[model samples]
Target: MCRLLVMFVMFLIPAWALGAPIEIAGRATVVDGDTLAVNQKRVRLWGIDAPESAQQCADPHGKPWPCGRRAANALDAWLQGRTVRCVQRDVDRYGRSVAECLVQGDSVNAWMVRSGWAVAYREYATAYVGAEQLARTGKRNLWQGAFQMPADYRRAQRAMQGEDTRAARVPPPGCRIKGNISSAGARIFHLPGQRDYEQTRIQLHNGERWFCSAEEATAAGWRAAKR
Candidate 1:
C-alpha cells in the first residue's frame, strides 16, 4: 500500500504541476522576427527571427516589402484571429516571457522553422540544428536566397549599436589584434606578415586572439589586403 501510494503521488505530482492550461486571449502584435506582444505583454517566441519592417531587401520584382511583410504575414496567418496556447518558460533578459506557443495543435517554433521563416538557434547545435540545417539546405522560405544567417544578422545589428567594436574597427595591416576563444582556454592574436600566421599564432597564443576565419573577419568588414 505504501509503494502504491508513492507511485500515485509521483503520477499526480506532474499533473498538478502542469495544472489547468491557462488560456490567454489577446491580439498578437508582431514586435520583431521572434517577438510578439499580446495585449501589451511582450512574449519572445522560443526560436525565430523574422525580418524587420524597416529592413530593405529587394524582392523578385526588385521591389521592397517582401521580406518583412512576409514574416509579419506568416505570423498573422498562424495566430491572427485565433486563440493560442502559451507554455510559459523563464522570462528572458528583455523581461518578456520566453514560451513555446501552440496554434491549432502545432508547435509555433517548429512551424516557423518548417516554413523557412525562422531558424532553430542552437548555440550548442542540439536536435533543433537538424531542422535548421534541413530548412537551410532545402532553401525553404528565407533560405531560398542569399539571406544572412540569423547569428550574422544579429551581429550586424549589434555592430550598428557599436557593440561589436572589434568588427567595427578596421585592424591595421601587419598589426596584431586580440580575439576571444571558442572554448575559453586561451585568447588568440592575429599577427600580420607570416606564411602560417593564423595557425602558428593560434597555437602559441592559445588564450589571447582567436584565429579569425576569413569569413568571420570579412563579415566583420576587416580586409586582409596587403599594404
Candidate 2:
C-alpha cells in the first residue's frame, strides 16, 4: 500500500520538476513589456501578452497613442536595473523561455497584467484573470483606452507585410541587363557596359524586366541602346 502511494505521488509531480528545474538569474534588460533578457537569455513573461514594439493604440478621444513603447518603458522603469530570477515554465515557438519571473520577491508577470501594461494570455494560462479583471475595472494603463490584442495585432501586421512583399518586384538571378520604356514609348535594353545603363532604372510595375542577353531583349521587342 505504501509503495502504491509513493508511485501515485511521483505521477503527480510536474514534468518540469521531474528533471532539474530550469532557473535563470541575472541583471535584466527589458526587451519589451512582457519580455526580458538575463545573461543574454531571452525570457518571455508567462500568462501575459504585451503590445508589439511598433504597435499603436487609440486614446479615449480616438487619437493614436504609442502604447507599445509606453508599455516597454513602464516595465523598464519598474525593473530599475535590478537582478531578476525566472523559472522556466515552457519554451515558446520563437525559442524564448516562457517563464514566471520575480524581482524582490514580487511576481513580474502578475504586476504587468495587474498594472494593465499587458493582458492575461487566456489562451495559455488563466492564473492572472482576476488581476486582469481588477485592472480593467480600475481603468489602469491600457484599460483606459482602445487597443487590439497583441496576438491579433501581430497577425494583422504580418498580413500587411505579406501583401507588400507580393506586390514588390525583384530582378531575376544573373539578369544584369535593364529593360526600360522611355517617355516616348520606346522599348530599350541597356547593357552592362553601356553609358545610359548606369542611369537606367527598370520599373517592373510599368512592364519592365531584366534580360539575360541582348537576343532575349530584342526577342521581347526591346532594342539595344545605340551606345
Best by lDDT: 2
lDDT by residue for model 2 (1-227), tens: 99999899989997676886689999999999899999999999999999999889888888989889999999999999999999999999999999999999999999999998899999999999999999999988888889999999999988976654443344567788889899999999999889998887766557777898999999999998998
lDDT of 1 by residue, 184-216 (tens): 443333445544444442322232333346456
Please report, in order, the local distance difference test score of every candidate based on alpha carbons. Answer: 0.60, 0.90
Best TM-score goes to which candidate?
2
How far is each candidate from the true structure, as Cα RMSD in Å? Answer: 12.8, 9.3
**Candidate 1 segments exceeding 4 Å error:** 1-27, 56-66, 124-127, 163-227
Estimated TM-score for each candidate? 0.53, 0.69
Give the poorly placed runs of model 2, Cα more than 4 Å off. 1-18, 169-227
Going through the candidates in the order shown, the clash numbers are 11, 0
